[model samples]
Target: MTAFPLLLLALAILSEVTATVCLRMASAGGGRWWIGVVAGYLTAFTLLAAVLAQGMALGVAYGIWAAAGVALTAVISRLVFKEPLTWVMSLGLVLIVGGVLLIETGAAH
Candidate 1:
């Protein structure tokens, strides 16, 4: 836990979510092109694999990564993709964050 790998995993998840949002935004325009989106996702996947190479368990890493990624992607979609934000969506995001917190707490044991 005191290793650089965990940080890398977090970073990879962040980058992955950002890339996903960017991809969505690009698709909305159809004219904006998607080379950046492609590059971002490629980099994200590579970094994720690098973190995995450092011996993190797949289940733990993937669960935290997916949950955090979804929450962050939702936020980014609202901001960058001009997606609407309802109270329900906001509450959902909160629950996702809470669940990820719980999972991480369990991982510490």
Candidate 2:
């Protein structure tokens, strides 16, 4: 029960990150690639709703998903788009991960 919602939340976030990457790629002359971006976002939101439908608490699920999404999207941006990554960015990602962990742990209680 819990695992299912969490899985869907993670998938939603990942899809969102993928969508953002695809959007950036499209903007950089990857013609018609925006379609992928649009589709990704659509899928992300749909999956997000499914997570909620599975009984995930809205605050916990949404917060964790957003934080994880931002961290992962940044990582993907650096890897797939060759975007610059600084020490600050790495530190920020770590903090985001930590924060998300804390939130999830709290929610468990």
Q: For residues 9-90, write the lDDT of model 2, one tens digit per residue.
A: 8889988988888888898899888998999999999999999888887877888888888878777878877888899988
Task: Put down candidate 1 lDDT per residue, 1-109, tens digits, no spaces.
Answer: 5578888888788778767766776777855547767777788788889888887767678877888888777777777667888899889888877887777678778
Per-model TM-score, in order, reads 0.79, 0.86
Q: How much does candidate 1 score in TM-score?
A: 0.79
Give the best candidate by TM-score: 2
Q: What's every prediction's RMSD, in angstroms?
A: 2.2, 1.6
Model 2 residue 55 CA deviation (Å) reads 1.0
Clashing pairs in 1: none
Mark the regions of model 1 whose C-alpha exceeds 4 Å error after superposition. Answer: 30-32
